[model samples]
Target chain A: MWKSKAKFLFLLPAVVWVLIFTIFPLIYSLRMSFYNVRIGQGDVFVGLNNFARVFTNEQARSAAFITLKIVVIAVAVELVLGLALAILFNRAMPARGLLRTILTMPLFATPIAIGYLFFTIFYEEGGLINGLIPWKVPWLSDPGLAAISISLVDIWQWTPFCFLVFLAALQGLSEELYEAARIEASSGWQVFRHITLPLIQPTIVIVLLLRLAEALKLFDIPFSLTGGGPGTATQVYSLFTYRTGLRFFDLGFASALSYIMLIVVMIIVSLFFRHLRQIYD
Target chain B: MSRKRKRTKGIIILVLAVAAALWAFMPFYWAISTSLRSPLETFTIAGLGIPFIQFRPTLANWIDQLSIGETQRALLNSTIVAVFSAVIALILGIPAAYALARFRFFAIKNKDITVWFLSQRVLPPVVTVIPFFLMMRSASLLDTRTALVLANVTFILPFVVVIMRQTFADLPVELEESALVDGATHFGILRNISLPLAAPAIAATALIILAFTWNEFLFALTLGSRQAVTIPVHMAGAVDTRGVQFWFMAVRALVAMLPPTLLALFAQRYIVRGLTLGALKG
Candidate 1:
């Protein structure tokens, strides 16, 4: 038998790395959140004031609202579209491999690059959609449309990811398992309805939760697309936090806001994941 | 199934697939077409600016983007940081993954321990970026690739551990247990049997982490701003005084996007197993 002491060695480096980088910083930022941190002037401790401002401030509230809106819309559309595509592709299709490779091209694209790509495409005057049409639509300029545009871009990018994962889940179902189900079923769709859906339900839940977690952290598209402009129209929660801490140098409030973001995400993830854990454990 | 009905179904699938492919291809088409156009010719063409038909495609944007020293430096730095970050993560994480897969710890459940490791990822980078900025600034690592790599390891390590843990768990434990009975050490078994079996997963994980580190922007933008700028940061700075340079931005977007996209395509075969975090594998 190996030394009991040596057993700890394998896990030590990861623990140390997390402590030094992740845990330390999280705690350090927790302290910073209580202070009124600014540029040039020294930090002044103002306990819960930053937290109070996060709740009261119009910008923060609106940013929160907009982020929620985008997350809900984008994730919903991605779910529907992705599931349909995945279900459609579960069959033996011609050139399936090539089609999959092509469809999933946007999955690995830089989000900021998507921001820029869509910027030009949606640029009212000489832009692609406008140039192709007779009307010069204000895609990025209109306040209501900008956030919708952001959701569209997210849908464009992540729908393929959902499709891929769902397809994998569907494809992973063994033929024997399906054959057994098929014996009791009258038609093909009945097999999917009775067997495939139930089997992949866990995967469905996980993918949905994964998409939700990521959607909550939305930053890149809005940051590059509008730069939180047209009067903070598309300024998401992350972008607002970035501007508060980095650009505005109000580190304390940003810290508090980020903490709140962290806590909210943790709560959401745990609530969702508790049910999922039973499937694996 | 009737032959006519099956044939119609195939045709429908083909048409739908082609339509989906076009939607997928639209962005690349726009970016590449934009990159090839001169400023004067950008809006002149009809029907999404078909090159050579409406206007001659120019290499000026590519030449302009590539000739910049910052572009070259950013490319080099991103390569260095991504490669080093991926390697360090694999080194630190694979051992832990193996341990989790094989050993039952004294106190903590392996499940709980695994969850703790995964929780590190759930903490958004923004939550950690501020303190990291302060810390990096104090340590004088603000503009170094080392700092970027370290910060990257914080997030990427969990992926390696969780995915590789699943990979190792999937591997037949019989061979390892038999090897142990034959007087092989646990480390020896991992080295000779577990690692070789898990090599494809390892390679796949490394490539994914590499692509991620390469495409990373937030930390690189904050921590490695000047001297250690990455492709994403460089691509972000593609704008000039005359508003956003669509052509140049297109060129830069293509440059930054091509590597990760190609790397992901190469790794796509493993992605079904690798990325689902073993949820489907069960």
Candidate 2:
């Protein structure tokens, strides 16, 4: 009995750490969302009023919709780029080791640093990209281009992460399956389509889901690159939350938005995870 | 009869693959060259001009960023946050991982624990930021190293637990069981047997987690203030200031990435393995 108590006692530090640091705060936010809370004012219990305000606010709704657009587009482009790189590097070719190392570079690159690099790449005057194009696009100052530019930086930095997962999955594939496909006179594209892709299907789905969740939470590149401007043009969900909570000090509304995001992500991951598990075999 | 033709086709495919990889690698090369080049060369060179050979290389920008009070302080701040989180993560993670590996606790299966740990990473930082800020303020930890470290442990703990679970799972359990038969306690068995056996995997996971924490930006930017600002947060402030141009801030940004970039190159193999854990398990 004493030893069992001691065992549970040893678990106390970690439990206490998480409770004090994470779980307690999550509960606090839940409580805050029920009140009319701001930075400087006494909280008044206004159950569900903050959530109602979130639904009615056109700016907040638009920001949420815009965030959806960014996530869908960014995740799609990165999926394609990442999967393609994975397949390319999986082939038995020269310098495959070196290529894999280079491909993973962006994953380790500091995101803010990448944002700074793209700031130069997409600048209007005296930028490398400006020289490549016949017309100057005002990549930074223009509203539409700014969103796309941020997404592009995200792709540059994170596509390698997806690539790494898919590459590992690809290498784990049985070489015998490819040899068997060859015996059946399968074309190169057909073998890749029917055999290799299906074999790594689980990794693809997992990578896609993780990237989708991550892209929805994006803050750094857009914040550093454009600061949710030219005029709220590239504002993503995380940025919206930041502006609402920090800039406006509307903790109640921000918490509501966050809960909404939590629901959306939970739905997406839960729906796909079952199918993802089946593919692993 | 067709052997020579097949070999020729293989050679062609190899050439194309190499060309494609080079195209992919060009941006990284550009970043390295841009960081190394002098400011005069950066302005004088045209598109696609190789920044390295076209002008004199100087460490002035690197020195400038290093010498700046805010930049140096931020670097030290990031180092502290990263090291603190890594230590906390390991301490919390290894035991949970051991239990999940060696024992069945309260009907929670191994897969369930793995899934639970992974979900933490999937939780968007935005979801927690509002609550986290209020929690920090209430706890008197806002805008300090402790707040950043604690936030990181939450952000990174699941990863540590998951990777360490794999490490523990791969280790032979019989040795520890034998230790137990010799009247060794759970803690004693782990300290003497399991830890030494799993050292390489643990080291690998630690390196990867450290890299991830070092590169983490959002929470670090939000939760940290002047005294606790990380390199990324500091660079954000530098870039966001009204009059700052790309040149001045770019120098700072490039300087900030040096330690992490070097770490990544050295641990590239472990990183690939670590990031891809449970990827096959779906």
Candidate 3:
């Protein structure tokens, strides 16, 4: 009995913190979603009206779609390129550790800084690409082009993440098993297709799940690059919620928007987790 | 028999690796080069970055940004929030991690507790940010560093619990068990036995948390206004305040970029394990 009580001490702070910060805020946000909340005015209870608007609001719906689109395109491209690079560098090399570290630098870089730097690089009048090209492109202005630009920058920053993880997973491959497989394999493609792919499939799934989680929250780059601009073309869901609440001060509707996004993200994540557990467990 | 083929493959890989490194390195290089250039030089020659080779570099932008009062205040706020939040989270989270890693609770299953803790990690900042924003405003704590610190703790705490739990779980338990038999309390075992063994991981975890909290933008943007602006938030607003001074914006970018980059360099060896939550030990 005393031992159990002693153990509870260890959990006290975390429990209290969750109760105060995470749990309470969740409860507050849920309550706020059901009310007509505007600052400098009293809250008026409006049952499910805000949630109904979330479905009705076209920008809100589109922001959700755009976010999912960018995440899929970016993560898929990153996985392929990163795996290629990882395979390329898996052999014996001098200064490989230094080289690996240098390649992974962007994983830790500030997204806002990366965003602005790319903004200049993509600038039409005197941008880096424009200096090399025969034509000036509307990188941030065109709606379709703007989303692609954001995705490209994301790819540049995150490919190294996939590369590093896949490299680690590849390095962890059982040397004896690989050597035995090599003896029987006829071609490199055959080895990768049969032996290597199956072994790294678990890593690939884990990487995809990890990347998807971070990518879903997409906020900083679009906030910096387009400011959700050229008219909401690149605005991710988080930024949409941001503009709605902070910029426009639509507190009630924004709360509903955020909650709607939260549910959507949770569903996506739970589905991924079921698949993830099938591999990991 | 395949020696010649192997040699050719090595050379091709070497060339591709160098090219990829250059491509990966271009932005950091550009950040430095662009910062050193004058505004006219920046806009006029975007493709050229080789200081004396491309254009004569200048320190005027860096010096100007460093001299600003808002820049100094924002940097200070960022440091205070990141350091305080990370420290507070560690104090609260480390013991909890130990409990989860070692002992199972009879009431709530350890797995369920861990899931509840780590679930905060994937929770969207906006969902919580709305309530945090309103509550902070009502509590008269909005735009203050304290509010920012609390918001940062909400995110950083989950990372602490998850990562440190892995570290503690991986530590050899025999020593801890022996210490307990020697009349050592769980707290004593944690402090004297587990902590020293996990020092490297603790430092790595702290540095990672600091880097993440430093780079956090959304909470800082929403909860912090005039008094509590972080480097990233301020850097985001640099173009508007200075009206697209590309050189100055470059300077601000470097300031915001340097801390996390330096932390990554210092903790690079442990970062993969830390980042993947000990899923991959790179």
Top candidate, metric TM-score: 3
Lowest lDDT 10-mer window, candidate 1 chain B?
A: B273-282
Off by over 4 Å in 2: A1-12, A272-281, B1-12, B19-24, B37-41, B242-244
lDDT per residue, candidate 2, A1-281, as tens digits? Answer: 01233344344455566666666667887788888785676888889988888789887787787777777778888888888777777767777787677666677778777777777778787776886788888998998788888877887777878777777777788888889999999898999899988887767777777777777788878877787888888787788888888888888888888877888888777755555333221
lDDT at position A59, candidate 3: 92
Clashing pairs in 1: none
Candidate 3 per-residue lDDT over residues B113-145, each given as its tens digit: 776776788888888888888889889998899
| DockQ metric for all predictions | 0.58, 0.45, 0.57
Candidate 3 chain B weakest lDDT stretch, 10 residues: B272-281
Write the number of the candidate with greater TM-score, choosing between 1 and 2.
Answer: 1
Cα deviation of B202, candidate 3, in Å: 0.5
Task: Give one digit per residue, the lDDT tens place, for model 1 in B1-282.
Answer: 699998998899888987887898898999999999998777666568888877789999999889999999999998999999999999999999888877878687777777778778767778888899989998999999999999898888988988898888888888888897899877788889999999988998888888888878888889876798898887776553346778888888888888888888887866655555545552
Which regions of candidate 1 deviate over 4 angstroms?
A1-4, A38-42, A174-196, A275-281, B240-242
DockQ, candidate 2, comes to: 0.45
lDDT measured at residue B75 in model 1 versus the true structure, 0 to 100:
92
lDDT of 2 by residue, B159-246 (tens): 7767666667778777877777788888887788889988877776677777778888878877887678988888778766644454
What ordering of candidates by TM-score runs from best to worst?
Answer: 3, 1, 2
Query: Where does candidate 3 stray beyond 4 Å?
Result: A1-4, A271-281
Judge candidate 2 at residue A139 and give its lDDT.
92
Q: What CAPRI grade goes to candidate 3?
A: medium
Error of 2 at B54 (Å): 2.5
